[model samples]
Target: MATEERNHVSNGEGDREEQEDEKMEQFFALLRSFREARDKRKHELRLRDHEEDINKKMKKSKASKLGNDERSSWVPRFEWEDFTSEFEFPRPLVVFPTPYNKKEDQKNQEDDDGLDLNLTLSSASL
Candidate 1:
């Protein structure tokens, strides 16, 4: 009876050790799963942030293109004097030659000559 009781106690201890090992394995599995989930969440958040950045850049590029297109089609009906008076500085001028027409060419020539005479007279006076 004494030997039998010793055998039973040893068997119980073995069973307890097996149970403890299984519990440890289960705990490790749970930890691994949690880490994987956390990493996945971080990856998703990074992708979302990159997508938002791309969207903002696209919007800015589209707006700039629209502005450039508007400027390209813009026609100024105001005179140089009106522009200069508003800006209050020596503004760079862009001259667009009118289509070939006899009267227009003659008028442009006369204007050029008048401008030259004005400059010469002003320099002489100074």
Candidate 2:
């Protein structure tokens, strides 16, 4: 009888140890899963912050470029007299000669003769 009681107690203790080990394993698994979830959330938040920062910088850069373009497009008004007064005569002027046409040449000669006749008549009246 004593040996049977001892065997029964040993069996109960073994069963209790197995149950405790299973509970400890479940707790450790739950803790690991929680930590992983927390880490994932932190990583996502950091990524979101970085994207927001980039978007802000892009907006600022675009705004600055637009402002520069607007500034460059502005033209200051000046008076016609001011422009004429600032002109320097006898400066090298680049002229592009068009292809000569006979009809145009004849018309120009006639215009010059008419001007000469007008000048003679004006001088006689003077």
Question: Largest lDDT belongs to which candidate?
Answer: 2
Ten-residue segment with the worst summed lDDT in candidate 2?
115-124
| Local accuracy of candidate 2 as per-residue lDDT tens digits, 21-97 | 99999999999999999999999999999999999999999989887866667588888888677677687888999
What TM-score would candidate 2 get against the native? 0.51
In order of listing, the candidates' clash counts read 0, 0
- State the lDDT at 56 in candidate 2: 100
Candidate 2 Cα misplacement greater than 4 A, ranges: 69-126
Against the true structure, what is every candidate's RMSD? 20.0, 18.5
> Quick one: best TM-score, which candidate?
2
Report residue 121 deviation for candidate 2 (angstroms).
99
- At residue 16, what lDDT does model 1 achieve? 100
Task: Judge candidate 1 against the unseen true structure and give its global Cα lDDT, from 0 to 1.
Answer: 0.86
Model 1: colliding residue pairs = none
